[model samples]
Target: WTIAQVKAVAQAYGESAAMLLDGLDSGEPVGALAAKMQEAVFYVGDAEYRCLADIGERAHDVSGLEFVALREGSRWKVYPVESAPGGDYFVVEQILIRPRDAPESSPVIAIVDDDPLLTAEMCSYFHSHGYIARPYNTEATFRAALGENVFDGFIVDWLLETGTAEAIIQSIRQSRHGDAPILLLTGKLVTGEANEDEVARVIQQYDVKPFEKPAR
Candidate 1:
């Protein structure tokens, strides 16, 4: 393909085919650019002929810029074929890539509290705000959940039916998701204060509140 052709199509797609070529010129890995071309290009050949065709097509841009490879002595060689019609290809000279919106990713929120009613309340709140909510009633269940999924944020009770919230928060901080936001809810002022000092130190944020059973 011609340099002008590559630049034209890239411009039509709002991408910088020329800039990509420039990046490749700088000796950078073309993997990312190649991947993007896989999405934009309408057709892609099978594995055997894919790379050669793409490179061959791109090697020729303007009429005179011939693809060259040295064999022996002082002579250079050029392939007989011209620009391949398909597979991932880019035009690298100098162009601009227009900014585009990124794909949407939903945030997840995890709730760790012994009270079923409280779990429901907190889950409902997060869900209403467009977050995917997961609830756990015990330390074991919360730990198990972490082994399977990652959360954007977490809400742990000040006191569990079987263990202290501090211990659970500490364990969470040590997990792969240790840096995730954790909001601790508690009815006792002292526990809240203590958590706010040490355990809550690692928490992104926390809330203290009195618990009331939900009405049927």
Candidate 2:
């Protein structure tokens, strides 16, 4: 990861902690606050477990709180101390540092598109060509997978059901796989769903190669 990427992650952690603190001060339940943070994707890896514990004599669980970051097998356990106005709350943030599956000999590609048929066909095509292709029908699932797995390349449709693929592209560029090849797939240019200038800007901004739909 680049220095900027590292700093960005750190900033996110700080922001998450602040958010948690604010929520607690505002009388929000710890579990609810944690759930919100989890949904916000502050931690990078797969969240193994997240819970609230008392810092007082009620629990006194200090097993891994001393260290800033702990490596457990393929995951990293992080403890971000939060001093809520109510008291101190032990916040355990577990992020998976590596993919659960063993590294593949062939390139692993992620295809993100809302169209089930297109996603399936692309996955099948890549699989036949010796690439391990994973298909996601929505941006949410693709983002979820990003935290759990590493991909050698990405093929994302320019437009998704929820929104444009700009956020997804930006995420890939900012992630550990910053140099990974990204191919933007879209039929919108021909269909008038997206303008040429918009498409060109995204392609140049992320340095991604653009492939028109029905790529042959």
Candidate 3:
């Protein structure tokens, strides 16, 4: 198969693997989800191939076939059947899909702001642009999520309803996401609600990018 065909097959396999994992993560039974797998058709270059899903049964069939390794997301490895030795090489018997150790390709951005509207808007914008943006209306919720999920970056409002975001920012800087990008949003600077010197010191110490709101 040509390079384009190879890419097309890889894309299809990745998507399928992601959907399967999603199903399993959502409490779906493994056997029930596996049974729903259908033959994936790939139009590579000027040719077409119907690739069957092998859920442990057809392992021997793909033993001799040339396998094309495709990495899907950070957790899964997909080996799609590329070419067979005998007749009807285009129509492969099975495609092997498995898990792999890797970081997530999709960036998970944390949007921490007290304003629910702004948080929602930021999350929506990031989602529209192909990112996994999670919104938090309070520091508590954000901290709770921080313990459960690994975020790629942070967009935090400096002034929350009850307190400042300095503690939250400090926690992030000292944590595993120390090198992650952090955008500090604050309308307090313009409104004279916070000390400019303290804000600047925090920004410098934490190595955070400060943005005065309303952000465009």
**Model number with the top TM-score:** 3
Model 3, residue 132: C-alpha shift (Å): 0.8
On residues 44-85, what C-alpha lDDT tens digit does candidate 2 reach at each position? 234533322222222245455531333334332344433112
In model 3, which runs have C-alpha deviations exceeding 4 angstroms?
A: 1-103
lDDT (tens digit, per residue) of candidate 3 on 6-34: 56766877754344435435575657655
Candidate 2: residue 102 Cα off by (Å): 8.7
Between candidates 1 and 3, the one scoring higher on lDDT is 3
TM-score for candidate 3, residues paired by index: 0.53
Question: If both were scored by lDDT, which would come out higher, candidate 2 or candidate 3?
Answer: 3
| CA-lDDT, candidates in order | 0.54, 0.67, 0.68
Number of clashes found in candidate 3: 0
Error of 1 at 93 (Å): 50
- Candidate 1, residue 108: Cα displacement in angstroms equals 0.8
Better of 1 and 2 by TM-score: 2
Tell me each candidate's TM-score.
0.42, 0.52, 0.53
When summed lDDT is taken over every stretch of 10 residues in candidate 2, the lowest stretch is: 50-59
User: Which ten contiguous residues of candidate 3 have the minimum total lDDT?
Assistant: 69-78
RMSD of every prediction: 19.0, 19.9, 17.8
